[model samples]
Target chain A: MGMCPEHYIDYMHDYLDGDITREHEQELKKHMQSCVSCQKHMHELSDTVAFVKSATHIMAPPHFEANVMGRLPKRKNVLGIQKWLRRHPIIVAAAVFFLLMGATLMASYPNDNQFSVTTQPNLVVDGQTVIVPKGEVVKGDVVVKNGNLIIEGEVDGNVTVINGSYMASTAVVSGQIEEINETFDWLWYKIKKLANDAMALFE
Target chain B: MDALVNKRIKQVLKGDQNAYADIVNLYQHKLYQICYRMLGNKQEAEDIAQEAFIRAYINLHSYDQKRKFSTWIYRIATNLCIDRIRKKKPDYYLDAEVAGTDGLDMYSQIAADEQLPEEAVEQMELQDRIQYEISRLPDKYRSVIVLKYIEELSLQEISEILDMPLGTVKTRIHRGREALRKQLNNL
Candidate 1:
């Protein structure tokens, strides 16, 4: 019985690799003795391997070492803080998160004893008195906490005075006048101010 | 030699910046040859080889001492070459022609008494044919063949460099050789 072409090719590789057993080797030799096609296939595979093996080794061009060395990245000092930060990314991220959190808290924190005041050209602050001068137009709202609001001019918007009194002389007040002396009103004002400051911080 | 290279690596880690030039000199030719054979373009090979060295230097601290330095460097170079091959469109014939012509001119000068001039010419032609055929193989097979025959690396080394199983590398080599044989037969 002769070996089939598939078996012949399989044995051919084993034979070339010296991996065939003695019995298989003898059987393959017997098949090869009569099979011209298997012999040709074997030679072609062997020649292919040999041709690749004999391919010339190409040397790098002149100054190749110099070129590579010049192109090499400069060694960075790992002891630097930037390197340390790179190695500990989680710590860096956590530090940044905490810093932002602290800033937001500071900006949003309510101060029970501090008050802010804004004055237009018509509204003036003189030592302890906030005065809206006569013959001047106040275009926006006027709010005063813990002090007296004196409007002697054209107040075109609302006037709110908290824990304080309001005095007007010929004032053209277009909006309502509010005087807040209750504790609930003070707490509400503080909450609104804190919210406004927080929004400004984000913007 | 590995011990010496390891010593240099340690020196580099210890702030000896110039010590890396020695490592570059040690493997430049081998790395360049592998890239040249794989890409079939001299300029690309040089550029890729230089990039490999730069990458290796940047990542030197991550090198595992258990493996050979040559294996680590070769792995970096081979990976870069494979990425470049995948990213770019195939320009097989253009590179083959340029490299083939250069190979013929270079080999003609060294093809003295060992073989007749006519046989040398035939050998050069065969070399060009093999290179062209190698460029046409699938990326996986081409990588194994170039590392195997051109670099003469052991199968185990190739497996390590490729991060592939030994059996898989063997199969690729077998398939690559078969493909080359079919091409040769066709010619």
Candidate 2:
């Protein structure tokens, strides 16, 4: 359980960590030849160190970046967010960004609907038609998919639609209104969303 | 390189979220490896690694410009790992999969050297046993052992990462290695 000559323990460890000087190493080698206990201790400790150093170098999982970026929390301030705003191509092309989001459908319906709309609490829903009925003041984020989004009322938050038409007859919006009909717009939407978010810092 | 990393940190602090991505990409593997060795679970390691980066991002204002960003981030991750290890009951995550099916193994090493299959499997088992023993180490000893042998970091760098005196680091490494040898002896 212990080195026979207790100080030899330091010699063994320094030797194992390769932190020993040539002089000390020679002394350690010379001592180990005649000292069975220290020799056995050194051998066992070397095995442990070697075994540890042999561990495999594990890489981050395949979706590491997406997981980090997708989970990057949103900030309420724009200037606090814009420095990263244009990092798109100057940063990343965000090509994969659009592709991964292709599966997010209606938050409430959970893919039951063809439209990938976010959940916008309060409003009107009739079959595939969703409406911010005129005069009705809807709060928080809203998304529409599969069916058309008719905005005749006032929305206090952002409105976004995916794979569906958006008709704003008399809609008064306080935030960004994003309508995505193509994957290309997804890229544009990303930038515009940042810009829109960036603008909030100034306001 | 550190100057560039600091600049990127400044950029991120100024409102560029994308700038942080570069930092994440650069250190993800290293941090992930540290977390994996420390926590012994791929899922928990990934979560802690990501948490470290996000925490750094949110607290960029407090980062000391004079410090090496790697050291700073490593400290953050090391602290997170210590917190995680100390919070859990002993051996709670012991069976959370110590084998790195995704990466290297000693069997492969022995096979590469053209050793016999029986010897390779035996060595592989020994290696696996060593990893599990490391994961089972007390938080203090495990930290020093992982930083020294697993990461091959300098004793000084490990001191900076763990924020302890150099002598304490050496003592822990000695004790940690001793503990590992004892555990492996039972095999």
Among all candidates shown, the one with the greatest DockQ: 1
Write one digit per residue (lDDT tens) for candidate 2, span B1-187. 8888988988887778899888888889999989988887788899999999888877787899998899999999999988887775553343344376655444342212122344444566655655566776777899899888878899999999999998889889999999888866755
Residue pairs that clash (backbone atoms under 3 angstroms), model 1 = none
DockQ of 2: 0.44
lDDT tens readout by residue for model 1, A1-203: 23465776767766754567888888888988888877777789899889888888788898888887777665555445666797899999999986775566556434353454566765688765788887788888887766788888788877888767888767789988877777556555556667879999999
Q: Candidate 2 lDDT, tens digit per residue, A1-203?
A: 35366777888888776788899888888988988888778889988888788887889998887788778877657634554555555444465554455433222223344644556666778777788886788888887766788889999888888778888867899988887766566656666666878999899
Task: Please give the clash total of every predicted structure, in order.
Answer: 0, 8
Q: Which window of ten consecutive residues has the lowest lDDT sum in model 2 chain B?
A: B107-116
lDDT of 1 by residue, B29-81 (tens): 89998888778778889999999988888888789877799999999999998
* Per-residue error (Å), model 1, residue A149: 43
Going through the candidates in order, their DockQ values are 0.59, 0.44
